[model samples]
Target: MPAKPRILFCHCNYARVVPDEVKSSVLEGLCKSGQAFDAVADLCEMAARRDPALKRLAAGESPVKIAACYPRAVKWLFGGCQAPLNAEHTEVVNMRELNAEDATNTVLNKTLTPNLPADGSVAKVEGEKKI
Candidate 1:
């Protein structure tokens, strides 16, 4: 059976929305380069759909796992993905803040950082948060 896909988030360090033009350019670059991986500009929005943990949060229920302790800000973006993810394999970069509104002008010659494991395994991205 084909293994489940790993997921990762490339977050901007800055706390702002990356321009739509920048996002499109990045995706185009990835497709042109023949790289493999899913990219989400608004991690929170993506998390809200795919992450079971974040789904629970959306439902207003508290998560039981240690992941319940991470700050909402850190998790608000990634907590929604389904778990059993390869811990050593997954990572989230702070990119929003770095890219900011000027993302179009700022060149990321290297487009779309890898967000998942190559082996197609799912992995957790963050720790728990305490209420």
Candidate 2:
């Protein structure tokens, strides 16, 4: 069986783009679920400084679910730091588009449906992997 995907939460503190209610509720749900997660104050700031953490986060071949604004933006941010995500193993939950509960559920779910855009422009929400 595939290992449970790790959760990565972004506070979006730099631009305040993610909705306040959604961010709080998601964080609450993550805490309540008791799942291990990495919560960063802001991904944009990390990308700007090329923080080593980004490289670490993108290191493992295991799947990762990132609770952030947009898939494309998340892809861009990581790529900028020379820590490009594994598009096939990365699932980006757009807190900007999804409600708090939905976002939380998506992140906490064991099933990983990779959401990174294939073309690098559009955001792909639906599961792209086919059996």
* Top-scoring candidate (lDDT): 2
Candidate that would win on TM-score: 2
**Model 2: CA > 4 A from native:** 119-131
Which 10 successive residues of model 1 have the least lDDT summed?
Answer: 60-69
lDDT of 2 by residue, 17-95 (tens): 7899999999999999988999999998887776889989888989999999889889988876667899999999999
lDDT of 1 at 77: 46
Clashes of 1: 30
lDDT assessment of candidate 1: 0.36
Residues 1-131 of candidate 1 have per-residue lDDT tens digits of: 32322322233323345444445554454456553544434445445456454443233221111111122344334333543332333233333443432332222233323233233433454564522
As a whole number from 0 to 100, the lDDT of residue 94 in candidate 2 is 95
Residue 26: error of model 1 in Å? 1.7
Report the poorest 10 consecutive residues by lDDT, candidate 2. 122-131
As a whole number from 0 to 100, the lDDT of residue 67 in candidate 1 is: 12
Error of 2 at 7 (Å): 0.7
- Residue 79 of model 1 has an lDDT of 33
Could you tell me every candidate's TM-score relative to the true structure? 0.36, 0.88
> What TM-score would you give candidate 1 relative to the actual structure?
0.36
